[model samples]
Target: MGEKESEKLLFWEHMRTPIAPQHPTLPKLLVLLILFVSLTYLVYTLKLVSTSRACKDAPFSKTIIAVNATASAAAVLRRGSRETNPEDRTDLRHLVFGIAASAKLWDQRKSYIKLWYRARDMRGVVWLDEKVKSEENNSDTLPPVRISGDTARFKYTNRQGHRSAIRISRIVSETLRLGMKDVRWFVMGDDDTVFVTENLIRVLRKYDHNELYYIGSLSESHLQNIFFSYNMAYGGGGFAISYPLAKALQKMQDRCIQRYPALYGSDDRMQACMAELGVPLTKEIGFHQYDVYGNLFGLLASHPVTPLVSLHHLDVVEPIFPNVTQVEALQRLTIPMKLDSAGLMQQSICYDKSKSWTVSVSWGFAVEIFRGVFSPREMEMPSRTFLNWYRRADYTAYAFNTRPVSRNPCQKPFVFYFSKAKYNSTMQQIVSEYERHRVPHPDCRWKMANPAAFDKVEVYKKPDPHLWDRVSSEEKLLQSEEVKGERDHGDRCGYV
Candidate 1:
């Protein structure tokens, strides 16, 4: 055969019968193995992703810092344990505090840090739109400046109105995404609010962080409660969201915010969002939004038996404690509270029909005891008198309410002021001394007709500065009249 024809025949022969010299199946088998492994990994990743989605909605476990975690506690029974690696009760971590500070007032966090922030053993982080760059090197601008203010657009949005809600929602997302997986309770508060960390933890201990808890107090004023639902916790007093709820909020908040564009306040917007999730405010009396401006003795004197968690509206009111500024009050609260004074001032308002007295105890004021228990048809100023030895013996030496009647200054007849008694003091002890007396007998009234002048009898007067001398003198005159009548009644009652 010719050479070319022979070469063609050899090529055809080689193509027809593949070489058995090497294993051709090896590379194909390797590719198949690689594909199989890749498929298995992809399935595993999808399962993990699905689990994480469900976990975001599942109830999460929490621990209190310094408070021991008990593994024996009943685990939160969730519906979908089908997760290959479910989070068990074995996952216990400390109480976590996530403070979402607005861009405008991040600097003012000093009060919180110095007061209650450092005392807590739990985890905490102040989430801000962006960290502040020190401007000490830059000349102080000719323009006025606040301690915690900036002009950045992002900062303003994070600190302002309904837009701030977006900031909070994002903080929750970022906080969890960046690995706060162990955080159980996420506490949210403003720049001015002061929390009693131990009391906060104590209060939180009462509830399971695993369950949904939107805990806080309502506004003290009816007008505020009218504007903001009493069902919502006033953010000034601060509020807590369970880890699960916070995560759930992270997912639902943006959509919720879109639904409520009219809500301009961060707190109210959050309330609306939580409402969408069917979570109502768990009213706790210990959280106080001292939304008033004046002495707190009157109200704090009557605090209830619950732990005091927070005090809001810092500089809005001064002298929250007797003779002390808001900062001073914050400092004082950090000191251990006497067990007897755990809950001093409660949100108490009651009218005694038998005695015809309308008594009320507020956060920063003394117990207001009014003679006519009935609500006024219209606002009326009943004549008011403030003079009694009892007044000298309270948390304050004198004034129970510095700004009584607010700026309106409502006066009532025989208005008696007394220092706050112990929280556990009986109703009898709490009432003003004049209130303790019943109507005088006819004979006693007649005898008091010859009411002696102050010069004629021994009397005690609260020492006052020249600014208060005139007012104090007038009060003394009222005291003289009331004393004589009381003396006549005492004689009639067989007292010496």
Candidate 2:
């Protein structure tokens, strides 16, 4: 065969195989199908690979350094009036009392180191022990050191009496990196905080050391029209920071300290620095920064009982004294009851009133009823005005009378429902009432449900019978005064 003819025949033979389609769209369709499959396979492969470090143990299983910054050494030595034992100066338990001192104003140089060592025997939870150094000295920054398998080296640097919280933070970041190269978390706190070891361990177990960084309360401040975002370091209340975040903070410490020099006096500013580093800050309601007083029971109930990490007592007197042992025992006993009651109260609000709403034997039942049903939507309706009279009248006449008012801040608003059989009748009554008068019947707009929709309905009895005794007496007094006024008016008219 000729070269040109053979070349042309070869091309036609390759193209004319069974794979060649007579239809124009079939090849295009097949190409698209193959491409789609290739893309899917790529995605599946990528999904199986995890990008983060996979530590087999708990995130905070590694040793942690707890740094406490106090105001002065004298404050540590002299127990305030609120101190449980004023005379026992040498006892280590007495050091927990100093957690509330105004370390900002005192000369903390000498005492901060002493208190750090004493805190080593803090309950049964000991993560690490390192000498506490005062931030007062102008020493070069050091890196974290590995002391042992279980114990890591740590340093508590006191920022020398409220000098600058920002500077202290920079010092803390620098100190944390000096001793441990791969610390899972770093804890920053004040002397006044009571550490809950078990709870701290639990929190640490939730995330990896690298994935987690900052653990605290998320807070933002609007001061003088300037909005500042900061995390409330439960860590400050004694929260823990992942090592990655701690290292990042240490690297940024110089820049942060220089940029916000005034912040050295503020704990929140130090946390703001961490936020700037892109470290995720997890806020814990369990870690409280406020004084323990008015709502002690409520506070204890709201927080986790078994895994409490720290308690910051700003008051001079210990709210529950007898040191750590007494506090632990009390918490163990009270926390469970408080949590149970809180749950019961939550369930009570959703109780179906159509069925018997037997109040639970617990005192929390009433609290739950108030929280779940009445409190949330009490003020939802608009006040009555002539222009918006319909809305006001309908709400006042119907919704208010049916649902109880809630007194708890966290409770959801109450709602009333009707059964399927009664739905039409109830709705008809509401419509009839609305047509005849300006105000509609209170039960008019309740949502209707099928009888089988609910497993049960609970009809609540009237709240405690004694609740209105004082109000009733006051009303009687007012009525008597009105009657007397009317009689005096009649007598004057007769005399005239």
Best by lDDT: 1
lDDT of 2 by residue, 1-496 (tens): 8999999999999988767447688889999999999999998777655432343342543312111213322343343322345452222221111121233422332232232232344311221223333453322221122121211122224354344343335434544644633345556555445444434544554445556466665221112012334444533366666666666776776666556544424455566676677665676644555422222322332222223445554333233312233344334323322232222111211233443221111122111111222222222221121111122323233211122322333332222211111112433311100001121223313344222222322332223222212223346788557644643332211000
Candidate 1 ranges beyond 4 A from true positions: 1-93, 133-162, 168-173, 336-496
Best by TM-score: 1
What TM-score does candidate 1 reach?
A: 0.48
Worst 10 residues of 1 by lDDT: 451-460
Per-residue error for 83 in candidate 2, Å, reads: 41
- lDDT agreement with native, every candidate: 0.51, 0.37
Provide TM-scores for the models. Answer: 0.48, 0.37
Residue 142 of model 1, lDDT score: 12
- lDDT tens digits, residues 1-496, model 1? 9999999999999899966787689899999999999999999999999877845744555233112223222221231132123453212234555565655675665555446554224455566655565545322211111222222233223234545555554444455554655676777766666776656765665567779989988765545566668788777787877888888887877677666655656677788888899999998877876554444443454454466678776666554444456576555544323222233333234444444445443322333444444342211221112222222322232222222332221223221222222222343222211111122212222222111111111111221112111223346788557644643332211100
Runs in model 2 deviating more than 4 A are: 1-161, 218-235, 291-293, 304-307, 314-496
